[model samples]
Target: MKFTATQTGKFSGPGFTARCVLGKGGVVKASQKREGDGASPAGTWPVRNVFFRPDRLDPPVTSLPLVPLKPYDGWCDAPDHRLYNRPVSLPFSASHEKLWRDDHVYDVIVELGYNDDPVTPGLGSAIFMHLARPNFEPTEGCIALEQNDLLTLLELMVPGAEIEISF
Candidate 1:
């Protein structure tokens, strides 16, 4: 199955569509995507895996691989680091994002296959589809959707499903 998230803030797949929020800087071509630029890379990226906070919610039901998030989970975003664009344990010295966030937004994270292949330094990192804030605020670089909508979509996604993010 294939899903799509557009610049107009619509996320659709199979037979359902829901509002979504993109990066603050909007969407850009994958090649033009830069670290910390606040723009979501525009392209079709595979759904790598799903990570959810077990303390906050029960494991989500989906065909995709799922992992319960650990408090020590983190994603290295420092371009200069060897582990850039990869998951790491906490206390990581390099600049990174704490996957175990205090905010509800990261409670349900859909890891997207962005900047992980060969991981070009500074291209981008930690791009995911996660729960949106109450007001549907823009994300740093990931896509955001309401909790219920995201959960519903996850149930319909298949193993090889990919999300096409476009302008």
Candidate 2:
């Protein structure tokens, strides 16, 4: 999959067009909100991993790529912290943080390789591709689509799938 930013929006608070590529399911319009700045970051990124609801009878899995969930999993957005662009557990003090809330959002996620320069602290963390709201509304820095579409994309995905967003 590949994404291109056809316009500008905010991810971490900056202008960036958020054009995304669905998993062979085509394109779906989505929205994002920056953690602090409320500006969407624009650029090329990769699908790092995938997660789904464990309580589900049979959570969907595909060749796109998968990563297990841990109690300590978290996404750090503290641009000022030493581990700014990586995933960190609790006991942290970052200004902008995604604590991997037990909510459905993180329950099914696909981490994006935005600023994953070295992969250690990764580029801005917590980017994912998960279920969208019934209204097909915007997101808080993640891509979203209909459940069926997502499932289809997952089935057609492979590890190292490329996601590009252009403006």
Candidate 3:
């Protein structure tokens, strides 16, 4: 199954008509995607493992590899760092995104396979499909979906499923 998103901020997959909030800058081609651009890169990317907050909710049922989010977990977004575009333990000296967020947005995260192959610095970092805010606010460079809708998608999704973002 594939999750496809449109420029209009709507997303569709095998059995769902879920609403998604795109990046504030909208969607762009992968070549145009830059670090902190706030625009989702257009292309098909594999669905990697999932990260969830155990304290807030039980682990979701899914075939994809799922793991619990630790308080000191984070994603290194600093382009200059050696671990750029990679997960890092908190208290990292370089700049990184703290996975332990109070907003609950990071409570459930799907780390899409974007820029991770060889992780080019300044291309982008931490592009994920995560829980949306109450109002479905625009993400930094991720696709945000409502929790229920996301849970449904996760349940039906298979390992190696791809997310296809188009123009």
Candidate 4:
């Protein structure tokens, strides 16, 4: 199965469609994507895995591999770091984003296989499909969707599903 997200804020799968928000800088070609550029990379990225906050919600219903998030979970985004674009433990001495956010946004996260193929440095990192803010605000560099909509999409997604993002 394949899902798609467009620049117009539309995210749709086989039978469901929901509004979504992209990166603040909008969408850009994968080659043009850079660290901290605030743009969603354009390409079909596989769904690597799902991470959910076990403290806040029960495990989500989906066919995708699921991991309960730990408070120490983090993703290194520092371009020059060896662990760039990879998950690292907290207190990690490199720049990273805390998967355990104070906000509800990261309660459920869909890890997108962006820039992780060979872990290119400075190409961008931590690109995920996560819960959107109440007003559907733009993300720093990830796709955002409402909680229910995201869960629905997850339910429809299969193990080998990929999300095709376009500008």
Give the TM-scores of the predictions, in the order they appear.
Answer: 0.99, 0.66, 0.97, 0.98
Between candidates 1 and 3, the lDDT winner: 1
Which residue runs does candidate 2 get wrong by more than 4 Å? Answer: 1-35, 56-59, 118-125
What does candidate 4's lDDT look like per residue over 13-121, in tens digits?
Answer: 8998999999999999999999999999999999999999999999999999999999999999999999999999998988999999999999999999999989999
Q: Count backbone clashes in candidate 1.
A: 0
Candidate 1 lDDT at 126 equals 94
Per-residue lDDT of 1-167 in model 3, one digit per residue for the tens?
A: 78897768788988878888878888899989998889999999999989999999999989999989999999999998889999999899998999999899998999999999998989999999999899877889798899998888899999879998776
- Expressed as tens digits, the lDDT of each residue in 117-156 for candidate 1 is 8789999999999999999989998999999999999999
C-alpha RMSD values across all candidates: 0.6, 8.1, 0.9, 0.6
Clashing pairs for model 4 are none
- The residue pairs found clashing in candidate 1 are none
User: Model 2, 100-139: lDDT tens per residue?
Assistant: 5645545667667765665333224455667666654556
Off by over 4 Å in 1: none
Ranking by lDDT: 1, 4, 3, 2
Clashes of 2: 26
* Cα RMSD, model 2: 8.1
Decoy 2 TM-score against native: 0.66
Per-residue lDDT, model 4, residue 60, is 92
Top candidate (lDDT) = 1
Model 4 segments beyond 4 Å from truth? none
lDDT per model vs. reference: 0.95, 0.54, 0.90, 0.94
